[model samples]
Target: MATNILVTGASGFVGKNLSTFLQNKECKTNALSLRNENWKADFLKSVDAIIHLAGKAHDISNVSDSDEYYKINRDLTIELFNGFLNSDIKKFFYFSSVKAVADSVEGILTEDEVANPVTHYGKSKIEAERYILSQNLPEGKKVYIIRPCMIHGPGNKGNLNLLYKIVEKGLPWPLASFHNQRSFLGIDNLNYLIYEMLIKNDLQSGVYNFADDKALSTNELISTVNKALGKKAKLWKVSKGLIEKTAGLGDKLKLPLNSERLKKLTESYVVSNQKIKSALGIEKLPLSAEEGLIKTIKSFKKEK
Candidate 1:
């Protein structure tokens, strides 16, 4: 019999992709929205797995109410996990962000790192994780908390989209001089890992971080985008000192590049995926970091 899967945030980019992938694998899938009134009902009793992808992301604009993150990311998650515990579901998957572990990673982030979330969004996610860990599960029940860094693909929107616009316009990238290594997870690889987790019954239940095998610098990313667009890479070697000053002034002058934005652009955030790879018994992800990124860039170009 095909496995029955219940997915929250089914309308999201990840959810849409995952649901389609699951269906293609001959699994029965259902998408539940946050507004669904029957979320806690016995409707989930028959589900083989529940994948929770619904949550309020960190408001990059810094305009959303702080309470919103906790209510959805923490409160709703606890309620759903409780339902899972009560139901017959054998596996529960929660999509957490690396930001929940650390807003900044000094070195390669491991599963052993002490979580010190800096933002309310991160705090909320960690809160949900703690609740799940605190509960006792039946012998056969398993829970997987996945922390992915900067997930990007054709339909997703994030920092990658911003970079794509710059490269698409043939504009010179200014912060290429920062030379920082950052980890990214491709949608394709993430989809494959989740599918494996669902099918592989012997895997341990715990927190796992996911990322591409190799970390890429901003310079390399710009080059990749340029390559996808069939344009010469134009990276200006701007002074870090001047960039910092300009960003500082942007804090009060209502400029586009603020201190926070600059930090995100230049900061090094390399995450290690060794733990997840080891668990999945895989040596490499399905797609190279470069190949997945180029695929996303080409989609953006096609959208133009």
Candidate 2:
């Protein structure tokens, strides 16, 4: 019999991709939106698994109400997990973020790091994780708390999109001198892993950090984007000091390249996917970092 899967936040990027993928594999999917007051009743239906993806994303503008993060990310998750404990569902997948551990990684982030989240969004995620961990799970029930760094795919919109616009407009990238490597997760790999977890019974239930097999520097990323567009990469080796000064001025003038945005662009945040790969008993993910990134960049070009 096909597994009946209940997915929350099915309209979002990750959820939409995952639901489509699962359905392709012949699994029955039911989308649960929090906007429906009787979502709990929908959750209690004959669902064999639950993939919780609903939560307020981190607002870089710092204008979102702090309470909303807790109410949805923390409280709503607690309620859903409690329902899972009492229900017949054998598997539960909760999508978390690496931000739950640290906002800025010193080196490579791993599952072993002690969580010390600084942002309200991070705090809310960790709270939800703690609640799920503290519960006395019944035998045959498995709960997976997955922490994925910057996921990108066909419909993604974020920093990757911003970078694509600059390159697509034939503008030269000025921060090529500020070299940095960051981890990214491809939606295809994530969906494949989740499908494996759904069918496999022996995998342990715990936290897993998910990312691509390799990390790529910003310069390399630009080159990949150019390759996808069939355009030569245009990068200017501007001085790092001048860039920092300009970012400082942007902070004061309310411009786009503020210090925070600059850090996000240039800072290295390498995440280790060894734990997840080891759990899946696989040596490598389905897509290499560059290949997955090229797919994403091509999607952006298509949208143009």
Candidate 3:
């Protein structure tokens, strides 16, 4: 018997990949897009589990209305979970962002750390998480809230695309000398973790941070991109001071690479995946840092 899986945000990067992957694994998958009318009623059918991935993404430019984030993200979560309270589903998966826990973190990020999200996007997710945790689940019901760092895969359009653009242009890579360790979640790793979450009934019901097995640096990431492109990596040895100054100038000049992006380019933030690994009783997660990165870069090259 095929397990019935219902997924929201079916058209998104992670949701689209997850729905396709579930179907490929012989699960009866039904996807719901946010644009569809009366989606909740359409979603209340014979679903064995529900994966909630719909929400307003972090509007980096801060142009969206204040109420929009809460209404769509926080309010929608409350509405959906309330609906689930009446449904027959036994398992629920919510895709939250690491940003929900912290906008800027020091040292290795852990699940035990106190959450203090700085942006509207993160705050809204945190609100949703609190709502779900406050409710008592019916017997045999399990809920897993996943907070993953910057996720990148074959079709991702986030920060990964920026790197691809810089590398794809065959321009002299200006960030070669920059070094910073950051955690990333590959689409494959996320799929595998969700599968484990469904299978491991004994796993605790709480927030779980998902990420790749290894922490990788930005310079290292560029190397992988370069390898995939089959070109000699052109890393410039620009001094950090000069780069910072240039970025400062960019702040006023409205240049493409500004001070904020430079911080993202050279910041040390590593998310620990030990919790999920222990919960799944797995020795190692499937995708290594380099392998997943190279695959993502190669995918972009093929897309061009």
Candidate 4:
């Protein structure tokens, strides 16, 4: 018999990729959009597992209402978890973000650290996680709260796409001097982990931080993008002091290179996936950081 899996927020990027991945694995997959009032009826059907990807994404534009995050990310998760508990689903996967623990990780982010989220988006996610943890699990049922950092893939149009465009345009990367390492989660690796958890029943159910085995600096990212473009990388090692002052001025003058955007582009946010690796009894994930990144960059070029 095929494993029946129900996915929420099936229209989103992660949901779409996961659904396809599961289908390729020969699982019976069903998509349940929260927009439909009859979603609960669908969720209550015969499902072996549930992957909850429906949530309000962090708004970098700063235009979204604070309540919206709580409503969708927190409240919706509570409703769905309650449904999972009551249903016959044996495994439940909740897609959370690294931002739920900290906006700026000083060092490598691990699952043991205390969560001190600043933004409403992070607050809502942590709240949902707390609620899920507080619940009692029945025998033979498992729950996994996965915190992935900056997930990127072929069809993704996030900050990575911005960098790819700049590199494709032959624009010189000016923040090469910032020298910060950040972690990234490839969609393929994420799908592999989820599939492993679904098939392997002995793995313990708890919070797990998901990231690539290696961390790459933004300068390295620029070079990788250039490599994918078959062009020589033009990385300008401008003085960090001058860049900071310019970003400060941009903050006041409403320029494109503001402090917030600059930090996002160059700050260090290394996440440790050792816990998950240990759980899976693997030294490394199937995809390396550069390999995954190059694949994503190549996909961007094909869209041109």
On TM-score, the leading prediction is 4
Residue 158 displacement (Å), model 2 = 1.7
Put down candidate 1 lDDT per residue, 1-304, tens digits, no spaces: 2289999998988999999888988888988776778666635667899989999988977899999999999999999898888777899999989999999989899989999998899999999999999999988899999999989999775789889889877789998678899899989999888898898888999999989999999899999989888999999999989999999999999899999889888889999999989998999999999999999889887876
List pairs with backbone clashes in candidate 4: none
> Which lDDT tens digits does candidate 4 get at residues 136-254?
99998899999999999999958898898898888999998888999999999999988888888788999999999999999999999999889999999999999999999999999
Order the candidates by lDDT, highest first — what do you get? 4, 2, 1, 3
Q: Which 10-residue window in model 1 sums to the lowest lDDT?
A: 37-46
Q: Over the stretch 2-94, how does candidate 3's per-residue lDDT look in tens digits?
A: 278888898889888888888777777788666666877776567888889999998888898878889988998888888787888888888
Q: How many backbone clashes does candidate 4 have?
A: 0
TM-score of each: 0.96, 0.96, 0.94, 0.97
For every model in order, what is the number of clashing pairs? 0, 0, 0, 0
Alpha carbon lDDT at 239, candidate 2: 97
What is the Cα-based lDDT of residue 101 in candidate 3? 90
Q: If candidate 3 were superposed on the true structure by all CA atoms, what would the RMSD be?
A: 1.8
Show model 4 residue runs off by greater than 4 Å.
none
Residue 196, model 3, lDDT: 71
lDDT of each: 0.89, 0.91, 0.84, 0.91
Residue 235, model 1, lDDT: 92
